[model samples]
Target: MKKLFIILILTGLIYVTYLNKEIFYKYPEAVRYTLKNSNELQRAEFEKVLKYFNKEEDNLKLKCAQVLISNIPLYSYKKEPETFNQVVDSIHALKNKLIIYSDSLKYNKRMLKKVQDLFVDKMNFLCKTNDFFDKEEVRDIDTLSSSFLIENINLAFEAHYKLPKKYRTNFNDFCNYVLPYRNDREPLEFQKRRELYEKYSWVYDSIKIKPLEDIVIQIYDDLKINIDFKKLSNLNLSPTPSQIEKLQYGLCRDVTNYFVLLFRSLGFAAGTDYITTYGNRHSPIGHNWFFIMYDDTFLPIQARSKSLIFSDIEKIFKLTNMPKVYRNVFNKINFKNSSINIDTDVTNMYRPTSTVQIENIFQTSNKEDFKLCVFNKKSNWFEVDKNFKLNNNKVTFNNVGRGIAYAVTNSFLEPINYPFYLDYKGNLMFLKNKNLKEDIPFNITRKYPPIDLPNKWKIDRIKALNNCKLQGSNYLDENSFKDIYTIKNFCSTQKSQFLFKKEEKYRYYRLIAEEVTSYTSYIAEFALINTDLEPIKNVKIDFYGTKESKLKQKSKITDNDPLTFGRFLNMKITFEVENNQNVSGFEIQARNDDNHINIGEEYELKVFDKAWKRVRKEKAKDTVLNYKSLAKDGLYILHNLTKGKEETVFTFDENGNQFWFGVSDVNDLGVGAPMSMGFK
Candidate 1:
């Protein structure tokens, strides 16, 4: 009996080795690494997948299995809690119940709101539960099933071969971009690749006959129309593809993952490109977008319909000044100077980039590496490029995004020097304030970049006020109005100012629209100009012929808030000044984001040395702020201390115009305002 048992154990060992023969024979080192990192069950699962692929004698499928097995050790994933699906199911049930009750007039908006609040509360509680939180992380090597790998590989191969000749990519690109089963930290599920492929088959069929760019547009449009990009209340959940499909909503990252997976399901070589943090200090949140490899180019697609822009070159130029952009890949990239291996740096793919070498003045005894960091919110720095050992006390960083401020720091986060930025020509401009006693007068026109214009839907807003008239009148009657100035050309600016030789002492001024231009011919701020072409002081305005209340309406026209608007819908709007004051000209402003200096808001100015130091604080008494006695050649930030949050770091020219970092050839007044023209 002992001899028989020994023979049987030997036979089972031989069978197990035979099943895992391809991985062990072809990639012995990878097999050893995977087995060393995997537990007993995971080891068995890996063997099962290799055995299944080897038995079928499918060499391509076996190669795919080997790729996944070799790379599985580098990734980790989270398992969804049991209560997660239960909560989602319960929410759906409640929604159905509410809908049925509402059919009989049994539930009102308040009742629905109460239900939503209860659901949010429950999900929030689930997010904080310690038991589920602590057990969330699990290595993919330890949990991925053999069946899941087999189905994912089989479906990926099937969809890949179905692509047209022009769209078909190489095997290496296919393996990295199209064959990966997971793009995010979401859980892996069996048959997900097959399920998604079947669901998106129709999309592939419809666009297969078209060009590569059209294919991307079709996919983007489908996602934009069907899926809603929303942040779920369950903050802890890294939603899987199945969950995203059901919810039809997710954050930018989640939507990006879904978009890539949908393209990969149809055998397109697709992946995600992301910015870990924006380069501008005011833009705190990072962004992610989908991209597909076509003709050896990464074609970018926005996450949602919020922008509706899909051109690759345009998106790249528009999203310039990003600190760093990284592309997701399956195999770990062994960067020469850094330990980070998951994502590859693609910053140069977006814009003109440069290599910078800096002297490490803050070197310490430890001889730790230095990093290039971008400025974020208040006093925080995000590492953009890291792991540069000081070569003779000098470190070189590669592919640096120009037009953005960067601070070099040691491993201890100690700065090597004061903050500095690169110009468009790759010239370093240090953020050092010349501590002079001389007073330098400059105007502050905007708090942020003027790139905030209308999207595709309202693209004609700037040209809408082409024929509108700026008139002056001594009487309140409409017949008494005289045309002070007529806008003969298309309005090409956010704030258009005109001055004419006029000696008339008119008590009233009016902006009248004759032709219907757009959905609404709206003006954000109507400024009555004095003889010197400055905004008239203490001006009062009133509207006539419109039933809309005039109680707070005058402020809408004169408050200097670009977001608030006063429309002239076949109506008369008048700006009344003091009897002693005569209107010489007028300033017309189109609808815009409220980033300009407000009349009543207080502003704080600061300059950066080792840290931000207060320069001055003043209340805005006019549409423009005339700052006095500021240091020369200093990087400054203007903060609206009263209410607003958006602020950009800037420097001024000899002409007292603001120059924003990262934005090229742009000033405080004209960051290419027409919305028709791209960024200047």
Candidate 2:
């Protein structure tokens, strides 16, 4: 039973590590396309919330971390294995629900990959089933588990071999192409990454993140501060992740790549979106901005800056911008005119990029009018034998059909968001530009989805900003939760050593320590403040130092909304430890409000332990000075430093309980603050 439990635990941890590695790697094509397309385009009104599916990396990671810890069984073989089975059932239910709604659009390409779909479904089942193999797992259960694990691991590889055909990465060139750009040049780390195929074969092969944010979220959580180069690189455009890693500041594409890379390193899923103006016979060449979803909320991430962007990317695909666009939809339009056939062969008629093409005067008469006529894509403008005026800049027909053509031109750019979603197959394929839909409507469908998909939630994305704001908090940020270290994680049964630096000089310094209180109750949030002093910025920071301190017991630094002079800068803490251990808290606080000013005078308060030897920082010189106490039984101390000078100072006492005058140490005094205090 013990052996079974140990193996299950180790296996689970190993699987988690495998998942993290995949999250940490970023593909280059995904980098460029996501930045240029996703950033520049606006999404439909749907604000999605399933974090992993959202593609905002931080949100996805948070969701993933929560799931990895939530309701997990203590042992696989426990008598009530039903509890374990229930958790597995819930995860599978979530996964299936994702499929139906994630690609709920009428024309989703996600439904196209049949073999891929089945493979993923099977893999999900095997993974969920693996969670049930605990100590109560008997020989029959062991046989079933072993068969499932081995069979799926092998089956996963066969699906892997077909990925090159699906995603376009030639198996051999892929790794070699990415190898040189990795963040760390260490040989072993490179090998571990390069040999990623053997470790988790399916990840390096087969699969893609639609909308992009979902993938980025998973990667961000796993990598956290340990982000790598591949995530921020564009192998197709920049051709190397190293270029992105080496850059300090960059353009919209560069910033986009950096963010996507960072998110992937932390173990979140992500999706991408790009844009291009029409090019001669091809699609758009020029394009603009970005959007991502994470933590169940969509983010119109600014691919251009560290800041976030609001809904600004025009979701329009311009056919007029195409260099040589065909004007043939008119060939299919039916007209009421018997002589001027609307179905006339205008197949060769096309538009130009350099100059406007027009049939100026095919008629013989100017005003006396040899003939009156018009042509339009909607076929409603083919009216003949009608009173029409043709001037240098004005062409008007008495009928309203001419006005309809103008409206169609403007409507092309107003298409719905989902039709432009990254995985959408439905797009505007214009037959003619500027012809106006005299009869036919523009090839645009601006409709809403029936549902928000998976779930509906308010995700904080960058809202429109006014010009006057100083700038702060977006809906997303970073976390510092590293996985728990155990015997297998660490080579030896030992605590990790951490060296903290108190980088800034301050007026006061103090270290604090506290104990762990409950099961799975790690530090959720922590912050040091200037509770008794004035506020200053950019002071050196570090937690307290105590050799006996446990790693999991130490408070973690976070960037979500935590206590700070500025906007919300941190969220949850990363500290964790067993509740059974006797533990104490550790914090290093320092204040140097006068670092930029001259200190002329200072004062100090001294609390004494009954023992004469108990004095704080005893190495300083002792000065002879007047001593006083609020009362004989209350407290007593001496005022230090000369009068009429403002100087930064520190206060500390050896609390065994003897009071003393700091007359010997000139460094221990403040001018006006000491004498007025009464013993409490």
Residue by residue across 1-680, what tens digits does model 2's lDDT show? 99999999999999999885554232222222222232221101001111223355444222322221111111122232454335335534544565567664432223323322443344345446544334243221112222222222233223334333333223222211111112111111212222333433434422343334333343333322221223322211221233233222223444444443333222222223332222211111332223333334434443432222232222111112111111111111111121221211111121111111122332323343322222121221122222335565223322111101111110122111100000011122122211222222211000111111111110110010001111111112222222121111111111112122222222222222112211111122233323222222233333323221333333232222112111111211222222222122222211111111112323343322221121222221221122322212222222323432221111112322222222111112221112211111
Clashing pairs in 1: 403-662
Give the CA lDDT, 0 to 100, for residue 56 in model 2.
Answer: 59
Error of 1 at 616 (Å): 2.4
Model 2 stretches with alpha carbons more than 4 Å out: 1-213, 220-239, 243-249, 254-680
Query: What tens-digit string does per-residue lDDT give for candidate 1 at 1-680?
Result: 99999999999999999976754655546655676678888888887887788855687777778777877877777777788778766765775787686767566544554554565667678777677575467778777888888878888888877876666688878878888887877666666677778876875576556666675666555543232323352364666777665444467777788777878888888898888777766755667888888566667776664435554456445445677788888855221221234578888887567888887665554366678888765555677779465577777888887767888877766678767887657888776687443455787787786563223323255556667777777788768998877776653335668776765577787877764543456677778777778888877767765545785667777787677877656646777788668667788777655677777789888887667788788898877787766665787888888887777788876666676665534232133323343311
**Candidate with maximal TM-score:** 1
